[model samples]
Target: MTRTVFFISDSTGITAETLGSSLLSQFEQQKFEHVIVPYVDSIEKAQAAVEKIDRVAKESGEQPIIFDTLVNADIRAVIATSSGFIIDVLAHFLGQLETALGQKPSSTVGRVKNADRDARYKNRIDAVNFALDNDDGARINRYDQAQVILIGVSRSGKTPTCLYLALQTGVFVANYPLTEEDLEERRLPRPLAEYRDRLYGLTIEPERLSAIRSERRPNSPYASLRRCEDEVRDAEALFSRFGIPYIDTTHASVEEIATRILVETGLRGQRSQ
Candidate 1:
């Protein structure tokens, strides 16, 4: 049986969902249907949410679970009347923090308004734009501005990894696709020579590479197993010859690849807010 789980917040509901999901993951045998109700800043909206929860509880014959991040007392009071198990995320910790710090907390809704937060948000946006602008070796001249440069054969998870690094961690990530000619040459591209210290390589198993390529260009020489094997072999050789660190991306997700790069390069401190 599946239970209903509601993530309620006065803003995007991201905080409620993130924390709630982590907590729910502990129950491995149960299934949950999630409902995110965001921007519940008003009493009317909170009442509506409570009514919805109550209706779900009656139909499912089980008390629904609610993860609430509401900071306003009036709005929170309205939601408290719902026929569900309420977990007030902020209220549980805010008082403890206030006592520890010897100060009253600012019970604000949504993101905290501050100049530093605004700057960090802007940096994230700028990083995303930089990743897009420099994707797939489009802007080699801009390598000096990049925090990290990813190099790999086509569809070796370079583009997605670069974008993930930029969006999630605000790292200026750029990717360069190593073509057949570059592989045959057995050397780093001229543009990447000056930035060798920032270069990270990604390789994939030939079978997986061929499979991915065949989907893009079926029945073509470029998608052949022989071609895939040759490219990956030479790419790995090139990385070794140049003493460049690399990772096999055959089974790694974009998030894993980006995280590995950050950890390997000791750039975890560069992660964004």
Candidate 2:
């Protein structure tokens, strides 16, 4: 059966959505329709949200699951009065945390503070800019500034993984594509050879690589299965020959790949600096 899930918050609703979706992932057999309602800090918005929830519950003949990060007690109370199975995501955890720490939280609304003034946010933006500047092996002179440099065959999940790491963790990341000439030569480029300690490799299965390339350039030699297989084989061999650590991205998400790279390379978030 399909269930409705609502992620509510006083701000962007990202926290509620992320936590709710992760929790829902445990029920592999269940299907869900997700709705995100953000900026529900006022009583009027809260009542409107409740009305929506009640309507869904009545129409579906079942209570929708609600995960709310709303910190205002009055808003929380209003939301709890709805027909859904309401989870006060922030209150439950923060309450216990208060007891453990012997301190009361600010109890203020999320995003009430200016994130633009945060150094972490600024650092994340800088890292994102760095990724864009150094993408696809551009501007080799900037290698020294990169925390981690990803080298991989085209369509092997290099560029996106770099950007994910940079944006999510404030890790300065760059990606270099292993082109046809480099794969054939089976040698590291002069520029990349200097940064061997920071180099990470990614390789994907031939069939998957071919399919990804086909989307970008259909019915071309570059997207051919044979070309993909050859490039993957050669890239892996180069990685092995040079002792550069690498992971297979064929079945991995960009988040997983970025995490592995950070863990393996001992990279820290630039935001923390």
Candidate 3:
């Protein structure tokens, strides 16, 4: 079934969207259409959001689900009048938090983005730069600085996973693309051989890899299914020979892949407030 979801907030709506996605993922039986309504900080903007949501509700014959991080009582009240299942995400836990902490929340609007002002933000930025610098074996000399090195065949999801780990956890990541020569040798590359402890492999199903690569180089040998199969098979064999742990990325989200790697490696992330 298809349902509409609205993520409304006074600022970027990132928190609302992230929380809504996490919650909605639990309901695997239904498919969702997501709409983000950001910068809804005023009564006027809130009414506009309500209008848009009501239109979807009317056309679909179902009330849209709203996940809101709106803090202004006046604006929130405007949203409450809308034809939707409103979930005040902050109010759900703020009262208990206030009582436990023996203080009231400042009810600050757009405070989530304040993460950019702290040391954690700089850490994430540095890590992202490192990922870009060392991507696809471009700067093998920097491998010694990386906490994790992802090795995989082209288009096997090495690049995005590395960036996700860096952006989310500040983990310095480097990636190497296993080329035909490296795969044929059935061993790690000379530069990578010394970093076996930090090595992690990623593999994807041949059919999917072929389709992905085909988008970039259609009808070329690089995108052929046979080539993909050969690359994946040989890559796995190399990982096995080196006793390097790996994961299949074909069906996993970046978050799932990155979380698993962090858990397995016991790498440190996110400094405490």
Candidate 4:
């Protein structure tokens, strides 16, 4: 049976949805139809949300499950009148926190809108821009400013991993695509030699690499299995020669690759504030 699930919030419903989904994941046999109601800061919006929840309950003949992060007491009261199984996310924890801290909660909308949060957001944006600017070894001179530099053959998951580290962790990430010349020479690029300690390598299985390249350049020598095998073999050998930490991107997601890089390099605690 499919149950109606509501994720309501005064700001973006990210918090509500994240917590709600995590809880729902434990019920492996249940299916849920999710409805997100964000920006419910005012009484009118909250009342409208309640009406929607009631309508869904009436239509489905089952009480809807509500996961809420409503900060305003009036808005919360209005939503509580709906015919749903209410789960007050903030109310469950705020009282304990208030008692522990001996102070009332701020109860503000979009808590991350302060000046310090704005500065941190700006830093993340700048890191994203840096990743894009230095992609595929475009701006080699700026390697001095990079926190980590990813090196890999084409389509080995370097670009996406760099972007993930920059956007999610606010780390200054740069990527350098190893070309035929660099692979044949079996040495790191001149521009990256000084940053050897910060270098990370990505290698992919030849079959997967060939399949990925075939989608871009079909039936070409560059996409041939022979070329793919040679390139990957040479790239891994070069990484070993230089003692650069590397991972095979054969099956790892971008998040996993970025997380592994951070954990292995001890950069997880160095994220931008």
Candidate 5:
């Protein structure tokens, strides 16, 4: 069944927007049709959206679910007629908050009063949002979608790189591991081969690689210095031979590595220019 969802909110409209985007991203998986109507800021816009939903429902003979977050009960009532599911998310939560605190929250921006502090918080939130929305596997077709890809062997810093890119640059990043099997064959996985044009690899000195691996898998052949050196050599050789660019992840911060990769790969300048 094709499902339609209408989103309504105020005050935290930005929050609502992100949630709507995430939900809409799943439409392909869920096989549901959806629409996001933000800033039900006025009775008129909400009414119009409601009317549209009504018209579509009658014509299609299917009731569409409406996800409403109207803080004001009056606005909620105006849209309630056509919405199959009217949810007042903010009110419900805030009501509980009021009950706990024994008073309503002041609408003042007191919690984020300092300009610099507010900006920092905003930036951090944006980075987290970018990470959740821009994971690595999703970056495959979307070179434009990635802030950067953290390419490395297991425990070679892919996850940290991805998290740093997200938290610092607000760029969506995804990481993929280069397995022993892939190194054995001296080729990227078949799936990654399709996106080789956008591929970036990460490497480290074999000794350092072995040290890090040992921490994760002590006394195992997988983390042996010899095995680590072989894999590192094989991976780097394969990357260089194929002309696929890579970075040495040793002794670099996430910011430094990500910036260098973007610059060297011409991914960042190309996008901006």
Candidate 6:
């Protein structure tokens, strides 16, 4: 049977339209014919739209699904209709509104709760996108507040590890490269030096490092085995001199590296995700 869905919203009609379009895209018409009507922007429009939907449902013998965002009288009348199912999404919105109001106004408690939730969600999407953008483990760091910072030479699996930590564990993970310049200077990057205790360095065998780089920049000096070995040794020596903790990422998967780093850094509880 063909299914018709309606999205009615008093406010954020664009949001309703966008979400409706996204939900519809998940379906293929060959298997299920579907329709999404968005932006029932007012009580009058919502009631009129319900009448139209009811007529279509009766004619087609199809039970329509109505996702309603109207929080006023029209929603009540529409819910009275018999030919379709009206889901009062506005009820949930109202519940959330009440919750927001019930908390103490102008308080850090309310602000921090909202801020942390927003940050967590934004971080997860960023992690997934970062994984896609830096698929080959290019040296990069974006999540600056990651509880567990990942330090590694180029192609030592730092990007994938940070992404996995962020996406799966919701742990903010910043990563930095132990570049030849930093190694030559016998110091960690200036930014990372401040968080010396939280830094978790990753090292890999020269041969594997060379192979991974060659795939990205073949025959270039950056991909040479000699450079890889030199950087690895220099980085390792610097870590030792600075007494910074480190990990060998030679055969570790993203999960393993993240887990080990969290565990060794005493951040198993401090960093989640």
* lDDT per residue as tens, model 3, 1-273: 599999999987877988889999999999999999999977899999989999999999998999999988889999999999999888979989988999988877666556555888889889999999999999999999999999999999999999998888899999999999999987789999899999999999999999999999999999999999999999999989988899999999998999889988889876222
lDDT scores in order: 0.90, 0.89, 0.91, 0.90, 0.67, 0.67
TM-score of 2: 0.92
What alpha-carbon RMSD in Å does predicted model 5 have with respect to the real structure?
A: 14.9
How would the candidate models be sorted by lDDT, starting from the highest? 3, 4, 1, 2, 6, 5
Q: Encode model 2's per-residue lDDT on 126-160: one tens digit a residue.
A: 99999999999888899999988999998888888
User: Against the true structure, whose TM-score is highest?
Assistant: 2
Between which residue pairs do clashes occur in model 5?
136-174
Q: List candidate 6 segments past 4 Å from native.
A: 1-144, 269-273
- Where is model 2 poorest over a 10-residue stretch in terms of lDDT? 110-119
The true-versus-predicted C-alpha distance at residue 190 of model 3, in Å, is 1.3
Which portions of model 4 miss their true places by more than 4 Å?
A: 1-6, 19-36, 50-66, 81-96, 268-273
Per-residue accuracy of model 1 over 128-168 as CA lDDT, tens digit each: 99999999999999999998899989989998888888877
Model 6 vs. true fold: TM: 0.49
Prediction-by-prediction clash tally: 0, 0, 0, 0, 1, 6
Clashing pairs in 1: none
Per-candidate TM equals: 0.83, 0.92, 0.89, 0.79, 0.48, 0.49
Candidate 3 global lDDT:
0.91
lDDT of 5 at 51: 88
Model 5, residue 132: distance off in Å is 6.1
Lowest lDDT 10-mer window, candidate 6?
103-112
The number of clashing residue pairs in model 2 is 0
Residue 212 lDDT, candidate 4, scale 0-100: 98
User: Highest lDDT, which number?
Assistant: 3
